[model samples]
Target: MDNQSLNADILILEGLKVTPRSSIAAFIFLLLMYIFIMVANIGLVVLIFMERSLHQPMYLLFCNMSVNEVFGATIVVPHILRDLFVSDSERYIHYIVCVVQAFCVNLYGGVCHTILMTMTFDRYMAICNPLRYTIIMTNWMVVKLSVAAWAVVFVMVSILLSLTIRLSRCRRFIDNAHCDNASLFKLSCEDVVINHAFGLSYSVLLLGSSTGSVTLTYIKIATVCLRSKTKTINTKALQTCATHFTLYIILMFSAFIIIILHRFPHLSDHRKMVSTVGEVALPALNAVIYGLGVRYCIFWYRSDTK
Candidate 1:
């Protein structure tokens, strides 16, 4: 096939092979899942903004995290749901749409990790140095950090997409339901050593830094817990850090599992399902954790006011 011919207008998504009966079930389930994700995450953000008392640095960061969850899930779940109802032959996406989706999906991931890491740092400062927490984590500082996180992820995703877009695509079939950096670049007939090198370096740097930050923060928190003679400090630390840690673990575990699944081409469907579930479910789970934590705090806040 000639390069021009291979530059088709659409790319086939061969991952979501659903029977007529199964398609209906999957569509309903995903629709409900996406709805819940939107409500939970958006609801948290709205509540934080409405309540004046919840305008602390912690809640502000939670608001940012929830917004990020919404961003990530929106980039993926609707597309998957749409693909489910379509016939096998019609299960294709536009060439430009695919590239845009790939960019947004990867941007979601990079930003997600950055926000989570920022939240961890917030928790560390709040717990390890209560006296200086307010001084260090002012609203201005949170805004700066949030802006920096998005800016960093935006640049990284742009670089990765630029590399893929430069490649001469000689294929149009992606074996998964969604477009991503790996699947998009693999469609090219040209050598992709640079792509692979940059992708690996990107993942390693982001994941390693985020993981290392979480680890060190928790170790410091643990140290504080051990020497603290007061139950009040330990309880406060647990309340502040528990939800953030839960979210960190869930996101990292889902991400690592998907990465491992990609290594085995034979489990394309398994990989597809895992990837879809991760993208959809992780946001919902994050919102739920944050909602519960916020509820607990609100209970105390209300009690104090009463």
Candidate 2:
């Protein structure tokens, strides 16, 4: 048989099978999480955009992050919940649907990372070059960076989706609850060296670059804060970067753990748990973490009115 025919046979042999699990509880949990993430992120974005007082570069970046979080969660969590609660027959996503989900998930994931790194740079410019901060982070600059991030992620995801759909599925039953790139790739009968190589290279490049940029930004901020002449200015600088730092640490560590777990087949369940936490839980918590500073900003604004 030709490669395509062989792959088709393998796919037919595997058939559709949903692993029996107590999906009801998982479904409820995921549903609540999706609601929470959507509400919190949407609320934050509205607050940042509507409040003229919050029209600074920092809050603008936060607004963008909030929007990205909403998109990210929408791409993955709803499907996971559906797969858990809905019947197996209803859970069978078409090939095109699966590819689209994977594409959007990866696209938003990449956008999140890039925006985070940009936020770090924004904080760095604010703290280290306060006088020139306005000039450096102009509206034009923000627009350009945002466009570039989305553009790159879109192109990358499109390529990945094309490669993924080209692969003949050897198995229809994905072990995971929802359609994930890694799970789908494992079911393919065709040689996946190119897909694997592209995935690994992109992960390393994006993750490493983002983490490094955030780390360096914080380090410089710290050094600058330590040597500052005024205690109040130093404190404010630190406070401003606090949210970004928290987000950076959480996302980078979670990503690192997920990647490590992914490399070991013996730890598949562990990887799933980690993936769940990283993808679903982390996005929800990020809205909270990043919003903490915003809350303080709002409080200060209110007090000033009094």
Candidate 3:
């Protein structure tokens, strides 16, 4: 058979396995969790947009991150919930749908990494170059950075997906609950050396640059805080950096865990359970972390003024 003939119109998803009784329970739990994720992230986004006082570069970046979290979670969680009720034999997703989901999943990760990288730059300017921060990270500049970040990620994801689409598929069954670029590409019958090489390079470049930026920026930030003899300066600077750094660490940690698990076939049985933390829990924690940070900042500001 020709490679095209072997390509499947409908791909089967060997989604999470659970008994009928547990399926309902899983559905309800996920439904509640999804609801909370939506409310928390959306609430933060709305609050930032509505409040004139919170229109600074830092909060604006937080808003971008929140929106991205919502986008990523919505793409995966709701679909999983729906599939929880689907019988194993009927749990099929169209080829087009799977491809689209894979694209969106890749897009979400790219956008997220880029945004965090931008945020690090913003924080570096604010902490390391306070006087010039207003000039460097203006509202107009934030808009530009945000737009540029999204545009770059879009281009990268498009390139990645295009490469995957060109490959001839030989399989129809995806051994996971959700669609991702790696899983989609694995179906190809032909050699995937190019695909794997490009993907590995893409991930390393994107993730490496982001991690490097965070490290250098934070190091500079720390040096600045230490050199300043003023206790209040040290306190405020550490507070701000702590918030951003915490989020950065959590995000990177979750991503690394997922990557590690995916690399090892032996972990396949436990992958779904662990992957849930990276996919769902991390986003929820992001909103909580930033929200608390905002609240603390407000309180600190009020006290200082008084």
Candidate 4:
């Protein structure tokens, strides 16, 4: 009994040691980054809600994106900040808490991706089928689509979390700073073949389906733009889609890099840093990129004052 207890304590200490101690400068840098992300994302959400002129579909979707950013960053950054301030002895989080945090973070992040894809489709329809845009993308349809996105996210994340939490973490050390879902699986001593298979299958299905849909929509939109006789309409369509295009590229590339890095464990530290920047820092820049790059946003702002 004494030996078993001592082994358990050792495992717990090993898990605690996974997160490296940060210097004062590193702590301050992380704090500043968190604050910047929070302020920028929250400020965009507020601006969209308050500005009556910005109540269009595009802006509404932007607001949702902003909200998701706030929720997603909060899930990771608060724990990171706390870990920085506290010692390992004081930093033990309950296994249940870790699982819940991982689930929520993935849920919001997935929802954000789905919403952005929907927004891209919405833009495509509006630009390519202007006369039928209203009839097709009705308020009712928008509401239903948004609700369905959330529903899918909830169902997928719930299943993933259920499977993850059932695994016994006998070897408690996690490689990453936070209790990431994949890292948690790595720490588990139980047979995780089922969990790994399901996770990969779901990810592939969801990502492939969504990417295909977004791609088809944009292809049709581009074709329409090419054949259009009206240069003004063509310009407007390009302007409207520019921000969404940039967002899609950023998200898809970042997600791809992260998954690749996670799978290929032998990748160097520089590669991991790139992935982190893609996932975390890129998200923080979304609002600024969209706002500055989209002419419609500027037009709405200027016209509102007049």
Candidate 5:
């Protein structure tokens, strides 16, 4: 047999598990969720782009997050639904395609985490040092921060992709609903030491720094709130932080689920599938919580620029 025929079996994704009876239900559920998520994310992106009043640092940071939401979901979900609803016989994704999907998921997610970090700092400045916020978080600063987020993710995930993609496949099964770096790594028969080392170190550096910075800033903001005697001041402080705080919670929880899924393989495939979905796609959930809940959105249509 030629090389093409010999390597054919190794390129397949065999871990997708949906019972034939449930495939229809799964397809329907995922389709609906994907549509809702896309619409919400797209709407947010367009709203930010159209409204000049919304062209502040905070909205720019959130615009990056919202765009990533759509990008990540598009990378993962449509394929999943296609596989579930259409590909009854051949459920295997090509290995190269899988690698690309895995890369995009991480890239989008990494950028979102960084954007949230920037957003929290913006909040800290706005609430804790309202006078300097405008001077500090200028249009150029916002653009640079946004560009920096994407640049960091691009470099790190490129390293991860380099380390993981060349490994020899021991198995084709992925054991989840979509392609993930962890899922792909587990299939490799070769030593994944480099992948594990670089992936872990990079993840810790990126997430840990963001988490610590955001936490410290929020703590400072809380102190500022406490220092103020006016009840309205405290309420406003809490309100300003509310959406970003909620975004942090949701992103962190999704990350926690990914960790649990990897650390404890004893968990059912069903659970892994759910956690997997939560990781790559949350625009619908976030739209309800952040977009609708934030007061800025209420003023999106108003001609007054703050």
Candidate 6:
């Protein structure tokens, strides 16, 4: 059995190896990052809610993204902080808790990508079909899209979690700071054919669909913008789409790469550390990106000055 294997009661999480000084530094830094992520995401959400002027489908999509970031941070950051002070067998987590944690993290990822796709659709309508934007993206329609995205992902990841719960683990040591389906399944000694198939299929289909949908929208948006004779109009159109695309890539690229890395099964420790940190850190990065780049966010910042 592996040194960190599952006993009857607990599964060891030995993913992060940090020196005592580094652990304390990491804890303080992560705690601050988590707090900033929560405050920024929640603050933006509250700002959106309070502002009647910001009640459009576009803003609502941003709100959905923010809420997902907060949800992701909540599920991920506390455990990392806990590990800083608690070590060895005390670092072990209940199997059920591990499963729940994995589900929430994946759930946030799926939903966040879905929300990005939705936002892209909103932008496409606004920029490419400006006259019909209002008529097409009604509040009722927005609510349906938002709810459907969350509901569909909940079902998808729920099935994933259900499958994970039934797996026979020969080893239970997760060598990372986070709980994920891939990490948990690494401990399995049985045939993982079905596990691999379904997991790979689900990830490929979901992420492929989400990113594909967004990319296609941007491509179409770009094509339409290029036809415009006004240089300023064309530049502005491309710039706007580029900003949204950057956020999508920033928020999910690491996870997307990590998902692909699972196929290798021989991923380096450095790569694993980068992926785990990216998973936790991306939400905070999103907040920072939008806070500085989004026009209304800038407006809010300079309101006192004006």
Model 2, runs deviating above 4 Å:
1-22, 87-90, 301-306
Pick the winner on TM-score between candidates 3 and 5.
3
Cα lDDT computed for each candidate against the true fold: 0.87, 0.76, 0.85, 0.71, 0.77, 0.79
Clashes of 4: 0
Writing each residue's lDDT as its tens digit, candidate 3 over 1-306 gives 556553467798878888999999888877887888899999998887886667789889898888898999899998899888898888888888998999988898888889988988988888788899888898899999999889998998888988999997888888788888888888888998888888888889888999999999899988998898989878878887888888888878877777788888777757876665466787888888989877877677677779
lDDT over C-alpha atoms for residue 142 of model 5: 91
User: If candidate 4 were superposed on the true structure by all CA atoms, what would the RMSD be?
Assistant: 3.6
What local lDDT score does residue 73 receive in model 1, on the 0 to 100 scale? Answer: 85
Candidate 4 global lDDT:
0.71
lDDT digits (tens) for residues 145-247 of candidate 2: 7787788878877777677778866576655544556766887888999989988888888998897888788888889888889987786787778777778
| Model 6 per-residue lDDT tens digits across residues 1-306 | 753554643788875677887888888888888898989989888877886656778778888888888888888788878887887667888888988899998898889878888888888998889899899999998999999889989999988877777877878678767788878777788787777788878988887887789878888887888787878667556655666888888766786677666666666466567765775678787886665545654464467458
TM-score, one value per model: 0.95, 0.87, 0.95, 0.86, 0.89, 0.89
Residue 281 Cα positional deviation in candidate 6, in Å, after optimal superposition: 2.6
Candidate 4's displacement at residue 138, Å, is 3.5
Query: Clashing residue pairs, candidate 5?
Result: none
After TM-score superposition, what is the CA distance of residue 224 in candidate 3 from its true location, in Å? 0.5
TM-score of model 1 vs. true structure: 0.95
Instruction: State each model's C-alpha RMSD to the native.
Output: 1.9, 3.8, 2.2, 3.6, 2.7, 3.8
Badly placed stretches (over 4 Å) of model 4 are 1-22, 85-91, 267-279, 293-296, 300-306
Pairs in steric clash, model 1: none
Indicate the TM-score of model 5. 0.89
Cα lDDT tens digits for candidate 5, 1-306: 787655654445544477889988877877888888888878877876786756778777877887888888888778776776545346777787888888998897788788888888788888888899899999998988889889988998888888887787778777666777888888888888888888889888887988898889988998998898989668756876887788898888777677666777777575568664684457778766656643455553362445
- Which 10 residues in a row give candidate 1 its minimum summed lDDT? 1-10
